[model samples]
Target chain A: MRSKIVLVLLLVLYGCSFFLRGEDPKLDLGDNVMEGVFFQGGYGMQWVHDTAAEFERAHPEITAYVWGNPRAWDQTRPRFLSGNPPDVFWGIHNINFWVNLHDGLVANLDSLMEAPAYGQEGVKFRDTFFDGTLEEGQFEGHQYFLPITYAISGIWYNKGMFDEHGWTEPETWDEFLALCETIKQTGGGVAPLTHQGKYPSYFGMIWRGLVYKLGGEQLMCDMDSLVPGAWSRPEILEACRLSRQLYERDYVLPGTSSFSHTEAQMIWIQGKAAMIPCGTWLASEMKNALPEDFDMRLMSVPGFRDGKGGIGAMEASAGPAFWIPVEAANPLAGMEYLRILLSRKMAANFLSTVGSVQPIKGSTEGVNVPPATQSALDRIAAAGGETFAFQFSGWYLELENEYRNALGALLNDDITPERFAARMEAMAERLRQDPDTIRFSRSPRGDGVAAL
Target chain B: MSLQNNGRVALLFVLPAFLFYLTFLIVPYALAFGVSFVKWRGVTLNMEYTGLGNFAKMIGDPFFWKSLYNTVFFTVLTGIIVPCMALYFAVAVTRKLVAGARFFRITFFFPNLISQVAIAVLWWFALNPEFGILSNFLRLFGFTDLPSWLGEPGWARAAIVAVKVWAAVGFYMVLYVSAIEGIPEDYYDACKIDGAGEWQSFRHVTLPLLSEMMKVTGVFLLLNGFGTFDVVRIMTDGGPDRATETLATYIYENAFELGKFGYATTIAMTLFLITFSLAMLSLWIQRRDSVEY
Candidate 1:
């Protein structure tokens, strides 16, 4: 009887070892278990499918499957909430990263960044991006988002049209306005500038760059910290006033307000307008419709004459970020997969295939990046190859909404620049008084300098 | 069978329907009402009760008031025109004035068959300033400065109202048509014999008999306009700086977009009360003061 009891006890103890607390979930290296979901917006779905195929081939033991949809975030919300999230996902545009991190839902990726780039000896993953490129993804002094692409926001114009009209891209606010006036007077049917007015948030690129141009880092810091009247500061107000000048002078493309991003983009690409303020993605997003000789190029917003910041200040950020949920079936595997996903070769594939400039340094050196992307890259190089972004309302949806609403009002001429500033101040004050709201801590000059 | 036994049998018959109603309707509504008093994000179990905190916030919120005003404006516009337009069509179709009355009925009711989202999209394209039918007509007639219908403040509000009215007239018209058909043939014969004209017959004979449906439809149109979201979301998204934001859209923005479930529920509760009270009072007035043939 004693011998039988001992045997059973030993068997039970061995069984417990496989099912114990705090053990890492066994890596699903077998052919059936790995999968990834991505938000397939502007970038087509086929690229993700091909990438997954490549990943599977590289890891013969695992059969990785990937799928994406424009509404991926909404479709995957239930899974995330049920603690059955996708192995790897890209969800920043639609999901609240700050709140998710606060709730301990997203995995802390600091350690993952420390891992050297896969298949690249002694080259850490953290060093691949330009300095400050990953700062936008930082929360609470820790990184939670791993950016895949570098998105540059600026004025997109037709190089051919500019040359034909003998119009030089302006380097100052006054010169920019004068160019707009010239376009309005002589462009025949074309307007000076068209905007994606249907989406008010697209105004961020011009506004953020111009804000830094006029107020420098201190103003950005003031805005980020929610200082009283931060929005009403002289330079911020000047930017608003200058932006409104385009609207008030009837230089905006007629019917531009009714246009979606694609519609407005079509107008710009067709040379029906002089310029459209947009991101570097414009050429890739509208490639199918663009005329072959459109000669699309991007220019940073002209520096305000009396501005305090660098003249070459550009609004650039690490974007279309990928993240792993803490509840993921295999987070380690997921992070490893991200390394391969963002590898230099894959970044090159992305540049050639999608015309997107990845945050990975040297990824596009030998690749045939589209001319529009090259123009943006050259301009960033001109800015000393740095990335800078403000995290004011960008970090908080509520404040962002209020800012956009007030900005919309200003653009629509429903309110003066002072009123817009006062409205923003009042709105921020109200939010600051709320104890339950989620607020992000940020520095005046952003969390880190842009990587170089 | 005894009368009490019959009553018991009737109650037994109603039990299944009552259970369904309790489960689907009352339960969820009760949950919403309970949530209105809490500060929950709705994604997790972390909910805190803040009795009347959300309501108090609503009272001080300018967006709420603006949205409420927008909804009321939409409801009033639809309430006034939808019935008039629907009644005219219903009368014409039933009276057999058109050459193909059956065709007209189907044609008039065609829009209701499409989903509201599809309808919104259809109108979105149809109202495009460049290729839209309206814009083409406007430009053809020398209106070169085509207004941005869905982009300007007042124009966006007008666009939403116009779309809602156009899409809704068919449903209400069908309701009026059914009600008109139900009125006895004898009444019309009597009117014709008395040498009553078409207008007089419609005013005296047709109108009185259709009052019940008219009341239900009027209140329905009013409530639906107040609760509008799908069309507005697809068309304008309450834009040009929220000149067209309705209460329903604002509630969604707070709940799903901004993650303020508690405050969203509070606003929802307020909207429910306004619509419920209006529906009940209107019914009470209708019961107390409606005319009879």
Candidate 2:
């Protein structure tokens, strides 16, 4: 009897391990069920849940099981490996979209894009979104990914503080520098500028804006395409020099480099710093911590006097990519879910809930947007479709990291502007030379060489 | 019952745990070993065989060398500093030389009870340059040119080491305290009966008997040092231009951030070899030098 009891206990333990490896029950719920996973980031998952519910309500034939967490990709990655991926997913930064496209993991969404809009009477699904917003998701003229939101990167400042201090928004690089100096002298102890230093890539937006200002949009395109010696251009070095001066002149907040994104933003919101560089999502992300009557506003990066791209060129693009796996159980359902999610009604709901804009055309119509996002929309309207986005950084991790690290080093005064340019050029050269490294090419917007 | 029946019972008891170990640990490691020789982008669907290529690439990569140097630096410094400080405190508290010995013991061990990520965040805040406790305290005097501890490369490494030591020394100190308490008091009494002074008695009796525990703690700390991921990941994120990039962080960056599974696993294999060899070498040295009491 004792031996039998011991054997039973061993068998029980083994059974428990097997139970631990059991598949998620939702997987066996049949074809009508569609699984959708998302990254619960700055924009909370309320929108995802609402969209899912709406999707299921609209298409009564399908059941949408959508879930998200801050780090949901950790769980989703294994599911992909096991050939049991969600029908639709978003925010797996590890999977390079281009590489996935090459490996036949991402479904080609060309037919979905060409399909008629879900709610609109006669508009194609592709036409429902704002112009130039859907271009980034295209690989070899086929859509493989779609963006959930749109954002414009710029310099954010407290309008209340600016008005009190008699500070006017600058339109040129020289005026911006003079304003910085004036702020340094008169704005009490507040620094002229601050940035998300721990995440050094925040500085890249400002740098890219400067690049576009000094050089033309074509120059930006050439650099993105990995054209030889493009990174070593004089315009690139000048942008490096101008950005470095922010640190050298002590215009940046002291010890800003040690701060996490939120810590730096908190300082900016506390009136410790006069301005900060961030995307339109900044105000929404910090809504809980913001003080009363902060009056946050964003301004485009000031252009140079001799710049080619003009001050109106705003670097606006879609954000937080979405994709459907090729092996999804319910591909049609997933596409339908996307159409519902991107409908103009849901887009307005997203703005009210998340305080950000979606790429859906006229999504901001009649929506009471927060002050900061309104500023971004105003900046975008003023640009009149003169916008550009860099695809190289998203495509190449090695080059992106090198550029970010080099930018950090340069800002810290650890390296010269020339050396910074050299490092970037060398990395670009290496990438261009490596046959195994997948490369993407594009021409300037409206250049007729690529489909804008 | 026969002796064979006892053996059968023991085998039955061990089988469940052994199967779990084989399935989770051994099989995964074997798979990783095979993957280290292939070129994979980590989507789990596509792989190309590249035998010895990943190894050669790792050998030639400057970033790998830098990470290795950083890892070794952290491990050696932590190993030396943590043990010495722990042993000293353990001796003091065990001997009751300090007042409020119980209070002191608990205070030292408190940090160990807290999570490592929490400790790192607390330290990161404390060392913040603008409004951090350390910076404000320094500024209370005339010192205004405070260095950015987490921003500058050299200072960031120093700061990481200090935080790791602070969080680690407590647990090791508790370990030493127990080991010292377990030493037979009769030996010390015998030393007192002789003309041996306190220092001499401790050197001859305490040091010799503690060697076994020392070896055990040494191996434990060595393993801990090698797997130093959480604190660094939370604190500096191997930043200030990768100045604090340890092998662990670099492996994570490669595999997850860059999707270079083959190269990451190759580095992992190398790290395992290095860790295993060093651990064995330390054990051999300890066994040879350990005094039989």
Candidate 3:
């Protein structure tokens, strides 16, 4: 009897491993119970769970279940493949699972965006957010991602270092190079600028700004279109040549090329480097690591000498966007939860809890913010309406990797400008021929890269 | 009723394990083979039947060949070194010639208890450029231009192999220990009575007894070397420009990072067949050399 019982139990467990609950019993969502999966931000995961709990209170009948995972995107990959993905994707990573929208796995958020926001009277959901947030999330010319958290990327610096040294901020290519020279000469083992070396993807901030400075928007357009000779343009060669000057002149911190992002950031915060290219969240990211009076500041990438473009442009992206999967069992409830998420109260809650900006305009005006965050906002306002810019790497991951490899080679002075451009051209050409590649195009609108 | 009923009950008892094996192992292996003949990105139901197209591309991919070379190179190193070193340590512990034999046994096996990722991270710190123990030790000798153990191509592959052997030798040593302990005491006694030295006794009595365990550990290391990932990923990430990429990392990059599941599965299938055949060949050789005890 005992042998038979053990055998029966083993068979049952094996069968249960492959079991799917299938559709909810009774096939009814009128019960108002639903699940929302979100990406847990580094600061905390409780923000989303609290928001969900508040949402349930407002609509008393609805019981919203929230699951916040740091790896929510990859965790839900199998479900997305099997056609039953989680209702929502909240926080974002460099690799977004929503890029599979072309596969009809994600629901278009157009209808939700068209509706009036939960508590904002006489305003559409789309109108309440900042310009170009939703535009970045458009796929196949339809709204797919709901832009929520907004972070800007630029060169981070310590004003105290520049002030104490009597060094002036550079506004053009010549001035920037001259400043680097001055910093190198003024060094007590301090580099003029440093960057995260291990993740060469961060090269996008400086390179994007430089390309715009040299080539203008038309060159960006050509590159995005994957034009045959676009990558080898004289402007590109010049950008590569000028960028490599830092390495040649010893302006980069020794061993910076060997450091990871956090390690390099630690070096910068400790005043070992004058500047580091980083995102707006750098202050909050290094809050605990930073000295109490670090006085962090932001600067636009200096324009090229006698350049046609880039005098009034910025590098930024709408990040940590949210979206719903098409096969969500209770999408209506999930969409309603998103409406609550975008509500003013929740937006304020995100700011108070997360210490980052939201996509809504005038959202950060009255909120208590870190001094560095305030400086970043002021700098953006002072840009005189600079065009918000993105590069090929933002759209094409393969092209991004090619640029990273090329830049790492450039830093070591292993490849010249012409060779770097040619190598990149070859990689772009190969990607253009790949049948599996997805393409998105953009042009610099009044402020940001709006979908074309 | 008694004889027939007993046979029927015995078959029923084994059915559950057989079903579980067929469900988990055999089914997935068969499915992976099917997936290789398609052009699926692995996130959808739509898989275009490319029918040997992925296989054809593998022949011309230089990156694939490089990774294969790295895998085979690593397998050969670990194959020869790990077992031999393990056997040496196992003998030292069991020979009763050394003090604190129990302590040595416990100390050697400690590394295998730590997780691979944690072990990789520990090595990463120990091999750090600025403050690493190895770097500091080298610097003390007036070596200013110390090469990064994980930065340069040659050093990176060598460092990975060295770590893997260090971590793996402990587990294999335990296997050697068990076999050495199981050897009948009479053989050692007979050799002792015949005026044999330590080397002669080990050669005549101990080696032949441990042969079966040696062959088993040999096959385990060979297959594992081909399928390695955790350490390689954490240490070099197959870089200094793909210098240390193995078949496992290559497939992972293609499938997860690059979203080319179809081609990745084809490479995996190729890896499986190669290891499977090599394992069979090893078993055959061991059988031919076996002595009935």
After superposition, the stretches of candidate 2 with alpha carbons farther than 4 Å from their true spots are A1-31, A446-452, B1-18, B186-204
Runs of candidate 3 exceeding 4 Å displacement = A1-30, A91-99, A160-168, A181-187, A343-345, A409-423, A443-451, B1-10, B60-62, B91-101, B178-212, B291-293
Specify the poorest-scoring 10-residue window by lDDT in model 2 chain B. B284-293
**Which candidate's lDDT is highest?**
2
lDDT values of the candidates?
A: 0.81, 0.86, 0.78
Give the DockQ (C-alpha) for candidate 3: 0.32
lDDT of 1 at B25: 99
Reference-based TM-score, model 3: 0.87
Per-residue lDDT over A1-452 for candidate 2, one digit per residue giving the tens place of the 0 to 100 score: 99999999999999999879878767675668988999887898889899989997897878888888777666677777778788898865555667677777889899999998877888999999877778889887778889987888889998999999999989888899999999999999999998888878888888888998888777878888898988989999999999998888889998888888999999999998999999988987898998877798888888877788767677777743888998887887888889888999899899999998999987888999887898888886786657767767788878888888888888888889899988988889888877668887877655312233
Leading candidate by DockQ: 2
Interface RMSD of 2: 1.5
Candidate 3: what lDDT? 0.78
Q: Which is superior by DockQ, 1 or 3?
A: 1
lDDT score of residue A48 within candidate 3: 84
- DockQ for each of the predicted structures, in order? 0.37, 0.60, 0.32
- Writing each residue's lDDT as its tens digit, candidate 2 over B1-293 gives 89999999999999999999999999999999999999887776688999999998899787889889988899989999999999889888988879999998999999988999899989999999988999999999978878888988888999989999999899999998998999889898999999888788779887788888888989988888888888889889988888898999999999988878888999999999999998999899887876665
